[model samples]
Target: MIKILKYTEYLYLAVAIASIYKIITLWGVAQQETYIFIFFAVISIAMFLFRRNYRRKFEKRKQDNQN
Candidate 1:
């Protein structure tokens, strides 16, 4: 379960990277689409950070309970 959580955190990062790439590629050709990608990239990065923090806290709490 912990491993799954870790993988999902990375998945969010991957999505953010992909969104950034799309934004760059479509910047000039499609302004509206680029904006959407930009929003996605921002949200993805935010989610990645949020999940990482939550995961760390969860691990710490688990460790504390064990010891």
Candidate 2:
């Protein structure tokens, strides 16, 4: 379960990276679409942070329970 959480956290980072690439590629060609990708990039980064924090807290709780 912890491994799964870790993978998903990185997956969000991957999405953010991809969104940034798309934004860069389409910045001038498709202004409206670039805006959408920008939004996605921001949300993906936010989710990545949120998930990481949650995972850390979960791991800490599990460790405490083991003692």
Q: Global CA lDDT of candidate 1, please?
A: 0.97
1-67: candidate 1 lDDT, tens digit per residue: 7899999999999999999999999988999999999999999999999999999999999999999
Q: 1-67 in candidate 2: lDDT tens per residue?
A: 9999999999999999999999999988999999999999999999999999999999999999999
Give the TM-score (vs. native) of candidate 2: 0.98
Off by over 4 Å in 1: none
Please, what is the TM-score per model?
Answer: 0.98, 0.98
Whose lDDT is greatest here? Answer: 2
TM-score of 1: 0.98
